[model samples]
Target: MSAEIRLPGLPLVALPGVYTPQDDTRLLLRALEREGVRAGSTVLDLGSGTGALAVAAARYGAQVTAVDIAWPAVLSTRLNAWLCRRRVRVHRGDLATALDGRTFDVLVTNPPYVPAPGSRPARAAARAWDAGRDGRLHIDRICDAAPRALRPGGVLLMVHSALCGTPATLARLTSAGLRATAIDRTAVPLGPVLRSRYAWLRREGLLSPAQETEELVIIRAEQR
Candidate 1:
């Protein structure tokens, strides 16, 4: 089962399963509009939960491919594409594996980035929020793979936690051969649930107490 969500003039269908769109989807949508991603450009969406970004790109007439590791996400993406009457290729696999031998002019992703404590191993879709020990595991992998996935002069847009591992993300992107820079940032208040979870991490020395404030970073990089 899925639900249809209308974002202003944009209509999107969300999966009833584990995958759902996050605020990062809005950030990417705005960035694409600003950067003028349109027809003919090929866009690859990694960790494409619910297919919002892919559908938006397709709506703009761009060729879009939405990839995820979860089968439910793949099904939802396909359903959403059908509802929109657009052709979006949905692949199910881990990271870049589904995109074998394929490249894109624009690559966008919003990966798992929450730094979970060792005691609390993630379960289900919550795993999508856990980024391993440093909260950069998934992000680093994405950055490392972007060079091969993106064409020369192509663009990569990603949203990650600035408080958790922004510096690490920048370093990883640079080391991965992409000239990365933060383009937009927004501070979102940590809900009580997250605050309590983060408090536990702080007490365990996994996160700094000063990290009570969470910042969302939108990074744009170009393959050089």
Candidate 2:
């Protein structure tokens, strides 16, 4: 499976302690574009990280708002937007809490989908990738909040590892009254976080001995 590449030539700033753009971010951006994130659309990017998606959307002429739980991430996103000469509202909050009562034309996220054995991330940069035991902590929360967060005809493009259960995400969105589908997928080698837990993953039957890669899926849900 092929992965999405970064936006060509957009200057980005990486503040220490912020999550940098990666395969997941690129995949979600591709999916978002395919789903029709165009000029004048109001877009929200959760777990905005380096604000790569936000900046990309702004370049496409969309009004964007990016949110991250970490202050450094929020700061980094703002810097990246400035570097790219695009304007994006950056906020510090958990998930959709910062946008309560606001709806968007599109919602995009490259949330922490790495399934870890801990009850919670250790803090700092770890919070950017370590999802709880099932890896659906943020995914589930996003799904639950989607219908309410989206305006009619709005779309949600989210990327996550398939190990976290793609079907669960689809079901949650569908049950919440949206037309949801897994629109794209790609396989990438285990990163340091996943590699570090390789043994535990094998023991938990989440990964196999010969599997050095993890499959990522982009779930697109449209509010109809």
Candidate 3:
């Protein structure tokens, strides 16, 4: 079944199959709202599945550009924008490549942070969930490109799993000349039982069995 999420004054639909919005998206949206993103600010939503974040930003009066590599995601963003009666630019491509030379005042992203072993290369959910070996593949690229795409003093708010090199992501953003900090965090219950990657990690002694909690980390960074 599909979940319906109401974000303050915005209405958005979550996908029934494949991907869904986690609590981290809500936390990131709240943080962005607090950061004063208004009509004048241009916002970018990376990996914008189902257009929840983009719709929320548009409702708040920001010009939003929603990008996803998958065609389904692009279609979702377009349809959601129509449903909400808001204008959002929807593009399909990898990372910010579809954006060309465009820059934004606010950038929001909920990237794939799952470290799936031996997954297919171009599957939609793989693009949405898997992030290479340590799950930092896409995260690293986003952090590196954000500084260049953001206006000085502009903010990049991102949501990622805490289990996959979160500290390294923070360090990467800092090294890329952006001031980074964790704005919010939440522990979500795991859905997978014994077949989960977490379970395998536990078995391999990589992670403790008590680490079934999925930690969502919200990071806020500003270009220097």
Candidate 4:
């Protein structure tokens, strides 16, 4: 496991209540570059926290759209897009309905994967990371929608903690008819949020007493 490091590219501004870009975000960016967004391609950034990924894709010549349920995140993403001089269509809505009839060539996401003690995260900043008890709330939904959200042969790049279950994610995506596999991964120390729930996570058998780092995996799934 190595220390968490943020990859450099564009500057982003996260509004007070918005989730700031982190390691998972930077990792997703790397994956996006590897996939090579074609100029004029359609890209969607689900749960675009600080718009880092969306702006990056736009800079790569993709027409990007970003969605986040939180208003602050929406504002933060719009602000970042403006600052970066990239045009990204941003929307504020729940994941299920955000892109009602939309499909894209590439879908990039870093959804919340923190296994929380609650059945659901309360509104506000907690929604940024507090996925349900098993931490697959958002991830599962994303997988289910991947098929309909992508164009034929489109690519889906997602980043999340291994704490939630990488195999499960790959399985779900494959079951949905996408060819999916983990493309990149790294282990980094748990941050303050996970540290705060250290006891609960240990008791839930999701973490070990000596485990201080969580593995983050970037999964790449292609629509056939």
List the global CA lDDT of all models. 0.79, 0.85, 0.79, 0.89
lDDT tens per residue, model 3, 10-45: 676665443666576788878887888887689999
Clashes of each: 0, 0, 0, 0
lDDT of 3: 0.79
| lDDT for each residue of candidate 4 in 8-127, tens digit (9 for 90 to 100) | 868776777777778888799889999989799999999988889999999999999999988888888898889889999999987676669889999999888898886544578888
RMSD of 2: 3.8
Q: On residues 1-224, what C-alpha lDDT tens digit does candidate 2 reach at each position?
A: 21222456666766777777888887887876676777899999888888889988888899999998888888888888887899899989976575689999999988888888957455888888888888888899899999988999998889999999999999999999999999899999989998899999989888988899999999999999
- For candidate 1, write residues 1-224 as lDDT tens digits: 66767675556676665545656667777887776887899999888777788888888899998888877778878877887788898888887575688889999888888777675666776766777766777887788888889888999999887746677778888998899998988777774435768767677575566775677899898999
Q: Tell how far residue 211 is off in model 2, in angstroms.
A: 0.8
Name model 4 segments beyond 4 Å from true.
1-7
Candidate 4, 144: how far from true, in Å?
Answer: 0.6
Report the poorest 10 consecutive residues by lDDT, candidate 1.
Answer: 15-24
lDDT minimum window of 10 residues, candidate 3: 191-200
Error of 4 at 25 (Å): 0.6
Please give the range of 10 consecutive residues that has the lowest summed lDDT in model 2: 1-10
